[model samples]
Target: MVLNKIEQLLEKYENAETTLQEEQELKTYFSQDQIAPHLEVYRPLFAYYKASKHETFTKDIPLKTKNTNVYKWLTVAAVGVLMLGFYFNTSKHITTTDDDLGTIQDPELAYNEVVNTLELISKTLNKGTATVGYLQTYNQGIATVNYIHELEHTSNIIFKNNK
Candidate 1:
């Protein structure tokens, strides 16, 4: 009778239909010293469930301290110092050749050069050829329209012949 009850409970557990009380009852019923031989296989399963409820972390060791913000501040300071050094080094060197001095001395001429480059790029993109697939589809559409016109013309010729 006890084994029958355990079997019913196990069926319900497998189907996820067992209540908390039914599960506790199953754990208690299986923990007895004398159990049916046929149900012995399920003994360890229930014992494991009961044992796991009391499982806890050991209290003998302390957790390590966290100082993540300090490391982040150090990284920021290192990057800032590097950027300052780079800026100072670059500022000391002049970037003008003899030709650049004559050309770049006027802001209006530099602006015109930039505008001309952009216009050239735009013109190149506008005059490009369509792809092979586009050309094929265009020719197919024209052929379809011509075929429809020929069919209409043939119908008109037959009507005139009948008259």
Candidate 2:
């Protein structure tokens, strides 16, 4: 009879469906030495619950006051400093003359300036390419001269071997 009741309470406990009274009953049952072999496994768990249930809060917590003069002043000062920094940053950009930012207002002039700059760059590149071409011709001439020198040197060795 007690085992049937214990089984029902154990089922309810695992499902978290037990009320405080039902939990207390289970805790009481486990606290006793007459626990069945299968139910012994749950004994320590209920014993811990029974032990923790007797504990009470010893200290009182203090609530906050409505007045916050110093704290409020500090918060306002922080916001003011942030606003001043933002204003200075933006104002520095705004105060500069149109000459500093330059001629986005004239599209044709910008286009002509870009074309002129590109032409100058390509002219310089062409001059460099022409110089590299002359170097390549000079390198080919030097290679041919070296090949002839090797052939003559080989022929001189053959002649000396014959003599």
Candidate 3:
């Protein structure tokens, strides 16, 4: 009689049609070592469910408060002190200087360097204009491809309408 009821319950459980009360009865029966020999395979599954049902994380987690503003203020104060020290140390060097800053000592050398820089800039501009001319060719090719795709699209539409 016991095995017959267990078989019926097992069928209902497999079909997910068993009620909570019937499920609890099945759990109670399977958790014991006195279960029938053939039903012993189901005991570990029920034991695992019973064991995991009571498990939970019980420790308290620490919460963050609004005391982070103190660290922000300290960081701002440290940066301000560093900037003030840098300004005072640099001001001494500026006040001690007697000659004009970065003035060219040799005028002919400065003029030669400027002329060489202008020549380099002119060469780079020529290279850029050559590349831009190639882009014109690329644009023409793209236009030709777009015309082909337009013809293909029209033919596809005509074929679809004929069907």
Candidate 4:
């Protein structure tokens, strides 16, 4: 009768309808030495299942150390310092005077001087304008000119109102 129950449980196990308790019972029955000769073929399968229940196939994976590129960061800092130094030097040179403050006294001359001074400032501040392609070069120059014109118009409006 126990052999018949074992055979039924094995059938349930094969059909994947056996509960965990039923599976454990099947394993228990097959693990004994008194199993029927006909069911002896299933002993190894049950042993594998029983062994797998307590056998852990999991492993603790060691984490890899992340490497940082400190030299790249150093290079970026060096470039930033160089850019700041260049900016300060160029700004000083562009604004420096030769003790002739009244030389640009005429408004028209002042306006042209302003435009030339702005162009020099833009050249110093915006070094990327030199490398722009022919297609974008006109647009970039136009944008700068428009910005300067807007500033000049605003200043003229303020000066006329004050006068």
Q: Count the backbone clashes (under 3 Å) in each candidate.
A: 0, 0, 0, 0
Worst 10 residues of 2 by lDDT: 97-106
| TM-score top scorer | 2
lDDT of 2 by residue, 1-163 (tens): 9999999999999999999999889988998989899988998898888788799999987788778899999999999999999999999889997677665668898999999999999999999998788888899999999999999999999999999
Model 3 worst lDDT run, 10 consecutive residues? 96-105
Q: Give a tens-digit lDDT track for model 4, residues 49-120.
A: 878879775888769855557877999999999999999999987897868556766789889998999999
lDDT of 2: 0.91
Best by lDDT: 2
Give the distance in Å from residue 71's predicted Cα in candidate 1 to where it truly belongs: 2.1
* lDDT, candidate 1, at 82: 100
* Global fold similarity of model 1 (TM-score): 0.39
Write one digit per residue (lDDT tens) for candidate 1, span 105-148: 66899999889989998777765643344887889999999999
Q: After superposing candidate 3 on the true structure, give the runs of residues whose Cα lies further than 4 Å from its correct spot.
A: 59-163
Q: What are the root-mean-square deviations of the candidates from the true structure over C-alphas?
A: 12.2, 15.1, 14.8, 22.4
Expressed as tens digits, the lDDT of each residue in 1-163 for candidate 3 is 9889988998898899999999998998897668888888888888998999899999988786767888999999999999999999999888876775756779998898889999999999999998789888899999999999999999999999999
User: All candidates' lDDT scores?
Assistant: 0.86, 0.91, 0.90, 0.87
Model 4 residue 67 lDDT score: 58
* 1 or 2, greater by lDDT: 2
